[model samples]
Target: MSSEAFRAGDRPVRISVQIAPQHLPIAELRDAAVHAEDLGVDMVMNWDHFYPLSGDPDGLHFEAWTQLAQWAEATERVELGPLVNCNSYRNPNLQADMARTVDHISGGRFVFGTGSGWAQRDYDEYGYPFGTVGSRLDALAHDLPIVRDRWTRLNPAPVRRIPILIGGAGEQKTLRIVAEHADIWHSFVAPDELGRKLDVLQRHAETVGRDVADIEIGNELRGADDAKAAALFDAGVRLFTIGVSGPEIDWAPVERWVRWRDAKNG
Candidate 1:
C-alpha cells in the first residue's frame, strides 16, 4: 500500500453507473454492465435488494454479490460493487471475505461500498428485523471494525487496500462513521444542500482525527443537468453516479455523463 495519504478533490471527475438488477433479463443486465465499461464509466454498480425498487413490486431481480463476482470476471477494468450494501444481510467477517475474493477476481478493481440496511420491505420479506433507524446505524458502526479486522486476518488478503465507500449523509451517525472508516463518502444531498452536509462531515472528521479532505465526495448524476453537475464539481465532488435499468438500456445519458467527465478532467 502506498504511504501517501488520500486527498479529496485531488482526483479528476470520474463517472459510475448503477445498473439496477431489476426489471430486466439477466443477460441484458450483464451486457449493460459491460457496455458501461465500454462507454467509459469508471465504476459499475448494482443494488443489494431482493426485489425491484421500481416498475412492478415483484420484478426480475438478482442478488448483488453473485452478479459482482460475474462482473469481476467479465470486465477488464472499471471497479465493481454494490452501490451500498446492506450491512445487516451478512456477517461482517463474511462481507470481508467476499469483498477480498472479488478484489482478487477483479485484479484489484473493487470498492467496498456499504451502508446500514434500509427498506423495510427487504427486511420483512427476507426475514431480517426491520430495526429502528438508530439501531441499524449503531449496528453498522459496530460491524465496520470487525469487517476491517477480518480483512487483515484473511489468509490471502485483498489485492489492495479496498477503498471503503460509505453511502449516506446523516450528520449525526453516518457522517461520524464515514469520518472514521470511509475512503469515499457518497452523499445524496443536492449541490445546494451539500455545503452544510460537508460542514457537518468536517466536524465529524475532526472528532475522529482524520482530514475531511482525505475523503472523496461522491453524488448521483440522475437529476444533475450540466449546470448542476458543474456546481457539484465546483463543490469538490470527485465522483458522480447515475442509475440505469431495464430490458432496453439507454446509453445516451451514460454517454453524456462520460463526455462531461472527460471535459471536466481535461
Candidate 2:
C-alpha cells in the first residue's frame, strides 16, 4: 500500500464487473465482456475455480488464466484479470509468466489479483494439497516475493508495473502481505468491518515501512442502492465491483453501479 492518503472529498469512482466463468459459455462470456466494456466499466474480472461455487458443482466452468488470455485479446479497453487467483493452484513463477503474457495481449491493461488459497473442493478435486488455512496462508506469504522476482526477470517484461491486488482480510497474516505487496486490497466486509480491517492493514503497513494509502480499497456492490454505494465510497473504497453470474448474465445491477460511479465522478 502507498502512503499518500486519499483526500475525503470528491474522487473518481470506478465500477467493475465480475463474470462467473463457470455456467456460461465462452461465447456468452465474451459477449458479457464486450457489454461491460461498452457500458464503460473500469475493469472486468473472473474468478479462479475449477468447479461452480453455486447452482451445481459439476456445471460448466473454465480455467482462470486461460480464459484471461482470451479476454485480453477480445476486449480493447476494459482492464481484465481474475478477481483473485489462488496462490496454491500454480507455481508463483509460472503465474508471473502467464500474467506477463496476458499483460502484453491486453496492451498493458491487466491487474494481477491473487490471494492465499481457500475452497477445499478446488484443492481436493484438482489434486492440490487441501492444507489447513494457516498452512495455505504461510505458503502464500513465501510465494509473493518469488512471484515478484519472476515478474521482474521475465522476458518482454510487463508493459508497466502491473498493479497487484490482494483479496483477503486475515488481519495477522494476509494484511501483512498486502502491506508488503499489494497495490489494491479487496475485501467483502461491511463498512464497519472494513474500517477495522483498514486499521489493521495500516498498522501492518507501518510495521513494514509502507504507507497504507497506496493500496486501493475494493469491495463488491451487492445491489443498485445509491445510499449503500455512497456509504462504501465514503469509507475510502474507490474500486467497487459487482458480480453477475450465469446461465443468464444480468446487467441491470451493473448499469446502476455504473450510473452511481458516474455521479461520483461527475
Candidate 3:
C-alpha cells in the first residue's frame, strides 16, 4: 500500500487514550477505560511494561495484555489494545492467538500494536534476554510473519482482520517493517519532525512496494493544542493519543480532544 492509497480512503480524525498501567488500582484502570469510551474516544491503549516508568520504580502496576482483555469486556464502543506489545516478551504465535481471543472478546475491535523491546528493566526483572536494539528489531522482523500466519491458522479465526500497529520511528529497520506490515504506525515525534520521519517511511514504503498512505499515522497528544493538532493533521496523522496515569485520571484534555476529533471528522 502506498501513501496515495491510504489518502484515498476515508481516514477520519480519531482520539485514543493511553491509560498507563502504573500508580493505580486495577479498578481505577477499568473505570478510566470505561470513562474514555463514555467520553467518545475512538480507542483506549495501555503500554506493555511490568514495571512503572516514572516516580517510584515499584509503584502500583499491572500487566498490559491481561488488563486489555478486561478493557475489551468492560467497554462497549471503544477499541482496545496495548500501544505496543513487546515482541520479545512472548512467542509470536501465542501473541497472535491471544490477540485472536481478545478480538473475539471485543467482537473484533483489537489493534495488535507491537514493537521491538526497549526497556532493559522489563527484561532484567522478568529474566528475558536484554539484547541490543538491533537484535530486538531483528527478532520483531522475524516473528511478525509468524504472528500473521498463526492468525490464519487459528481454529475460529479473528472476527476481523486485526489491524497491526507498529510503534517507533527508527528510520532504517523500524520504518521498513512498518512499510511492509503495519496497518498503523505510531510515534511520539513533534509535528515539525513528523514530516521528515514520514518522508523516510515513504521511501521505505517505496522500496518495499507498499503504500505508506495505507498506514494510518498516529501520534501522542500531550502539549498539543488545536494549532499543533492541525499541523500534525497536515503531516498526515489521523490518530491522536493522550496518556493518562492515575490515582485519578484527568478527563479534561480527553473531552477537549474528543471534541476536536468530532469537529474534524464531522
Worst 10 residues of 3 by lDDT: 1-10
Residues 95-141 of candidate 3: C-alpha lDDT, one tens digit per residue: 99999999999999999999998999999999999889999999999
Q: Model 2, 168: alpha-carbon shift in Å?
A: 0.8
Candidate 2 per-residue lDDT, tens place, 121-165, comes to: 889888998888889889998998998899889888999899999
Best candidate according to lDDT: 3
Model 1 spans > 4 angstroms off: 1-9
The residue pairs found clashing in candidate 1 are none
What TM-score does prediction 1 earn? 0.96
Score candidate 1 by lDDT. Answer: 0.88
Q: What lDDT tens digits, residue by residue, belong to model 1 across residues 1-266?
A: 11123344468888989999998877778888899999899999998999989888788999999899989998999999998999999999999999999999999999999999788899999899988989999999999999999999998999999999999988899999999999889977888888788888878888989987778889998866989888887777888999888856778899999998888788
Ranking by lDDT: 3, 1, 2
Model 2 scores what on Cα lDDT? 0.86
